[model samples]
Target: MPNKPSLTTPPANDPSLDNLGHPAIPFPSSANPPVQTEPVVEKTAEIMQPASEKLTALRAQAGSKLRSETDQAIRKLGAHSEKLYVSQAKLLDNCHSQLRKQPMIFLGLAVATAVAVSVLLHRQMR
Candidate 1:
């Protein structure tokens, strides 16, 4: 044998080197202590985030639907109010026409009563 090397010293130099002059990363330790937390905690947070976002979207949709329904109801009420006004005006107009058409009937009744009273007074004087 050529000669056995001393155990105290490391190898003469590393085999791999980069142009930037930094050493590569070494392998991670496999025999480290177990993590304190369960893996489910991280997974639950990932699952919950998307669900909350979807819930907010649904709430916005419902609010918009409610507003649309309320607007329609208001429009219907306004249409009914206009209809009521037109009906009242028609009723008043009909009453006025009836009074104008019967003016001659009223005058004839008044003249007949006055003539009857005059004749009765002349007979009594005789």
Candidate 2:
């Protein structure tokens, strides 16, 4: 009769088996221990510091540029408004001269405008 190996006995060539034929419990290796995270945290902070400073500098530059552009726009608006004021004053002076030269014609035009507005308002109410 042939001999059959029992389940409790490990093969002789298995290094993971103890002298008692039980599986050997493996201990953590000292050469490859869990990494200490302090260095990584410090390195991350060091990298981010330069980025934060750059962001602040960029924000300052953007703010200065925006302020300069806004000042230019305000100056342009002021110049345009001055030009419009001068043109309007000239137009008013011309109108005044024309009215003084032809008082009767201006009075007739004013009466006609009033009559047209009254007729429009009366139709709107109806």
Candidate 3:
């Protein structure tokens, strides 16, 4: 029997074979070139221009509205903070006047409160 070439081994120097020995699919070569794409791109841009402009205008309007609403909310919070400070100051002044009017009563109440707290603490420690 004579030694024959195996079917598993591809033929060497085959023009149709790629570097890895697989058959290469035919691609567009110098004979058939790709079509120009610039006109298609320009048409698409023209179609989208109106929507793009509307989107930009909407964005600017929304930003301005948001800033105005934020400023209104900040002003409201500032007013509330000022009112709270005034109320708190008035409460402190009232308490001071009451303490000064009856110093003996306030001193007695403070001592009694301290004694009660100490007794409660001593009980919890046990």
Candidate 4:
């Protein structure tokens, strides 16, 4: 008779596939830490304990990471605000310098307008 093709289970002696058909071996169980092996009956509790501990550690790390991110963002905002303030101060300084350089022009225009108004007021009074 010819060998029949199998679908679910591999041949018992097949070197490639385990009984469960999962690539020769199953994934490692957390219960049997590489350091020591637990009895089959104690595997479930051993696996659960490690998973919970890892989760707690991850949570603490996540909190610390979030706090660090917030602090960095605040520092960046403060730096940008300081830069904006400095820019405004520089602009105002430039305006004051230009006004100082052209003082004569402004003074002349002010005196002329004042003199003309005074003359008109005197004529009106008379």
Structural similarity to truth (TM-score) of each candidate: 0.43, 0.64, 0.73, 0.41
lDDT of 2 by residue, 22-125 (tens): 34644334753666799999999999999999999999999999999999999999999999999999999999999999999999999999999999999999
lDDT by candidate, in order shown:
0.78, 0.88, 0.88, 0.83
lDDT of 3 by residue, 39-83 (tens): 999999999999999999999999999999999999999999999
**Candidate order by lDDT, highest to lowest?**
3, 2, 4, 1
Q: 105, model 2: CA deviation in Å?
A: 0.8
Off by over 4 Å in 4: 1-46, 103-126
lDDT of 2: 0.88
Encode model 4's per-residue lDDT on 51-122: one tens digit a residue.
989999999999999999999999999999999999999999997997899998878988999999999999
Clashing pairs in 1: none
Tens-digit lDDT track of model 1 for 1-126: 698878874454554422234346433236534455667788888889999899999999999999999999999999999999999999989867866899777578779988999999989999
Q: Which of the two candidates, 1 or 2, achieves a greater TM-score against the reference?
A: 2
Query: In model 3, how large is the Cα lDDT of residue 50?
Result: 100
Q: Candidate 3, which segments miss by more than 4 Å at Cα? A: 1-31
Report how far residue 75 has shifted in candidate 4, in Å.
1.4
